[model samples]
Target chain A: MAKIKNLAELRKMREEQQKQLNLREKSNDPEKYVQIKVGMATSGIASGAKRIMDFLIVELDKRGIEAVVTQTGDMGYCYAEPTIEVTRPGEEPIVFGYVDTQRADEIIEKYIKNGELVEGIIPVNYESID
Target chain B: MAQQLKMQLLVCGGTGCRASESESIEAALARELKAHGLENEAKVITTGCFGFCEKGPIVKVHPDNTFYTQVTPADAREIVEEHVLKGRKVERLLYTDPENKEHVPDSRHMGFYRKQIRIALRNCGFINPENIDEYLARDGYEALGKCLAEMTPDAVIDIMKKSGLRGRGGGGFPTGLKWEITRKSVADQKYVVCNADEGDPGAFMDRSILEGDPHAILEAMAICGYAIGATKGLIYIRAEYPLAIKRLKIAIDQAMEYGLLGKNIFETGFDFDVELRYGAGAFVCGEETALIHSMEGSRGEPTFKPPFPSVEGYMGKPTNVNNVETFANVPIIINKGADWFASIGTERSKGTKVFALAGKINNVGLIEVPMGTTLREVIFEIGGGIKDGKEFKAVQTGGPSGGCLTQKHLDIPIEYETLVEAGSMMGSGGMIVMDEDDCMVSMAKFYLEFTVEESCGKCSPCRIGNKRLHEMLETVTEGKATMETLEKLKNLSNVIKDTSLCGLGQTAPNPVLSTLNNFWDEYLEHVEDHKCRAGACKSLMRYVIIPDNCVGCTACARNCPVNCISGERKQVHEIDQSTCIKCGTCMEKCKFNAIEIV
Candidate 1:
């Protein structure tokens, strides 16, 4: 937490910071861990994304799943509330829609834990905003 | 440790969403979480504008990425109980895609976000603007650090020039050139000015940027200070933007604490600092000279531009001024090479421009797209088309300064040069989409009315010419305008453009001229037929009782505030045209759909 004195120090700090922001996974290698991105736009949040988020993090830790969860800006599917794009190790990110606490736990148990898909899978038809 | 572990619930606390009770939504969420004893496991936080104001009061659940739209405070308990406790997604609250009628569970799949590439607005809805750590975690200050330690003033300016980032503040002047001019200006004291005074009628992009990502502006300003050899930076934001001003103050203080701004920043011995100056929200103060004058405690009036603000600004010192969005683009441009930035937009205008997408559009919010993205894409793909399936008639870009572009110009790539060449300059990106219902004459009058009121009156052409333009528009909408008045309006607008002292006067007649060019037939219909086809101008429209539809139930007569409807009960009724108020109350009250407008 010291003040960055030079460019080298700043770069080092950025490296550490980048690891923390590893939730975003700029490398795009899904094999590292289970990656989950919560649609955090106004629409998603208004439809109870908060509740779903709390459920996912708590249940994941309790269930002992090695998943890195992060908040991302809107991907434009506002009609779908409590949506999450889940990427298992060495798998394509499959987005699930209308995720409640029950769905969140089911996804962590079946999808993240057992590598099985669940209901409310939002079909991906467009490229994500990189 | 507990704070970061638990799921983070981000509620939009932007001005628009906050007005729609997002604060109460946040508080309701917090209360509901505690009631269920999940408060410790769930953290409810208020972030900045989510840009999608139409579907505001957004609640985003982290890790799962559940995007909830149009959430009410009443839905808080159900959210906590069903979604939080029972792990069940709320069915009714989910946003139903207009196209497929499918419940879209993710924001990434929405039509509104398909084409948008968020750079200037990257952090808007994602991060809490008040938090310094959040900003730092997003690679915020690294640009400033790199600029100071790695690149010289000339080198930094060269990158900016190569990036081809023109000013997002309407004029489309090159940002690098502006900085170089300031760098070359021999001055005892130099300054970096951030123009946060966004005065366009429908535009809120700048305000949202400040509220959503205040640190972006600060970091960019610090870099500008280093690039232009300035020690002091000033953000001249309007006083009307209370939320933006509040967020900016927090960001500046946090930057100072983190050694990002002020003395010895990034250990590079760069003694740059940012200060906030509040404007009274004068529309003319958006002009650089007027903004500088307003900052220096003078009347917000723009003088001649032989010596632009770069040469002499802010108490007659060399100052470099960049609009909020322009600065927001600076950091990423430096981080991701000039080529990376330049490759996104058109040949002339590189990087993206943030637009406050408003008016009759389905997705009324803020958006950032690459410069060449056509108006059609913005209106349909990103905007989710016009609201209520209304046919798009025209779109007014750049507020009063820009022109009205019709269906023909939809495919034209929206660059600064293209917009200006098509008779509309890309003024501070405010795209107000008009529908079939919107009267062109009335729309023109509305803009001219704004200009006439906001003109500083320092120049006679703007003062008198804009007023005359407004009057002619008024006459047209009233169906009393002669052909001579139209000719007079056009000639007067040209004269105003030529003789104006500043940008305010120079572009004041754009709406009138643009509307006249794009919607000439609509104007002629008003002047010749004495009718408004769109039924927008109340004066040119008349309320009538359809004889075939009228049941003579006396509903129309009873409901008419002016008692214009006459005829016996259960018989064919007629609306007394002369006495009718055109309030449409009778039409609304009539269950039989009896009333019609002629």
Candidate 2:
């Protein structure tokens, strides 16, 4: 830790440290950021969902995208094994099925950064009670 | 690196929650997280007061947003295993609504926090206070940086004046005006003082701010130093608040390390330093003059204010003193602009007030609500009404020096002028609610006892006057005062209020005066009727044995300490009222509901 020499240094240090608290800031208002929910139930974990979730978390930060990545219970898509739900601000959520680390990268690059639909799209087959 | 953290377990590390083993809860959560290998995925951070202290030690799981109340250290494993691993909420630990018996998921939906604005307490429960990085992440010293880099001294003061923030330390004096007064005062050495000696009985708002966001106070003080042209700052805090003192020391050290407090702060050639002066928890020291006197190693007694602390404060120099909560609001006002801070509260009073909500309230905690909020909304909606479904009675705002307001005053907006008009001043935001069982006379007596004990005795009106007032209240509660005594009590209270020197003596008689005005009939019952409706005054109560209900009931006679009950076997008993001590032991021992108090 260096002594803050001036206002510029203080402001720069604050910006660097602000990123450390970005997860908390994003969770406070999930709608303002890109929200990704990884299915982490037994079925999802059996298909290496943990690696994909970790990959998404690290890559999203590296790419300088404001996003919240959280784990959900079974999305009731056991057949897909590893699935993820991606919901942009004020939009319908899109679930991608059988997501390996490569597919997760593709989802981030195309669907998230470019706003383009990618392969392995799992459409909503059931309706919520609400 | 921040994105790696998937969840946050925010354990409340406030003094109240710490007393309830929140430290162990934090440790337990950490251990459980390690056991599950989720330490990296989930972070355990101990935050300051959530203000929901009744249900503490509170464990709030962030990102998922699960608020668990009254969480024991043993419940940590279940939280990590169920909530963290399986993404499921612990059902039993959730806060159940006292009304609907439904489990509240998070703090947002709960009635306790629903009405709160939380300006002063914004980063309190959210960020880790001890960690300076966390503070910096929340734009901690950005206000100081902005003020130094862009704004002039007058510009900063102008912004504060426009924000309309008054002193939260009971005076309600404009903070900007106080700074301006000190700025104008010509002195070789100027001082900026923070009055952290919060002596109100049920008040901990200052303590919470100091403990939770100490950096905010340092930042605000530096900003004040810049405004008032003071190089030296002193925090006059009470010795009783050990945790607050500890955190303040840490924050000052951190700020100094960052070159935010020491010489040449922000490399702008402005040198400012802050030091802490501990008081012996004297109530009079909360007054600015007395606080300065104490800081100067003199007796903590207030002198007349012809030359106010702004002109002649510590060592007879120009000084600007602000409360902890008042300083806590400064950085935000600077960051968000004056109009943003001014828009929330009432016409005269701006920004939210943090109150330590206590006494007969269902959710006894700390709350920050906007001005002009009705007492009814605070007590019923936010405070969760009176405890045990009891009928609402009078509420004593302020502390010993404040007045008690009754049911009719509930709808009045809680502004500075409004509270003073309703026979109570918002003295440091100690809102103590009373239930139907609480006798107003006894309540007044309780406050008088505090004033009598805490009085500095510098003035006869306060020292001798409060003593006499306490004795008079004693006689009234003991059912020994005549109508003449009541009249004398009223006159003496007025005299004390008029002749007292400082704010302490001036407001010492408020409890007595307010209760006398509001609950006159209850006081009259003690004097004339010799009856206490609430049965709080034991001297006014006469224990009588119901003739028809009693059947010999030697059980009561056997249990009576004074042997006041007399009866033959299988016959109705009579209670010897003169001999009875009113201990209620006979009443408890009566198997047949025989003993009754009249």
Q: Highest TM-score, which number?
A: 2
Q: Which residue pairs overlap in candidate 2's backbone?
A: none
| Candidate 1, superposed: residue stretches over 4 Å from native | A8-130, B1-6, B35-40, B543-596
Off by over 4 Å in 2: A113-130, B1-3
lDDT of 1: 0.84
Candidate 2 residue A52 C-alpha distance from true site, Å: 1.9
Question: How would you encode candidate 2's per-residue C-alpha lDDT over B421-447 as one tens digit per residue?
Answer: 989998899999998898888998988
Enumerate the candidates' DockQ scores in order: 0.16, 0.56
Go through the candidates in order and give the C-alpha RMSD of each one to the true structure.
Answer: 7.6, 1.8
lDDT by residue for model 1 (B1-598), tens? 2433445677998999888899899999999999977887667877878777878878876544567899999989988776665445676777778888887765776787778899999888877888877777788788888898889999999999999999999998999999999999999999999998898889999999999999999999999999999999999998889999899998888878777888999777789899999999899999989999999999999999878878888888999999999999999999898999989988888888888999999989988889899999998988899899989999999898888999999999989999998989888989999999999889988998899999999989998888888888888888789999889889999999999999888888888898889888988899999999898898888877778988788887887788777899789988777777788898789888867778
Best candidate, DockQ-wise?
2
Indicate the DockQ of the complex predicted as candidate 1. Answer: 0.16
Worst 10 residues of 1 chain B by lDDT: B1-10
Output the TM-score of candidate 2: 0.97
lDDT of 1 by residue, A31-129 (tens): 577778788666887888866765776677567676776666576677888798888878888999988888888888888888888898999998865
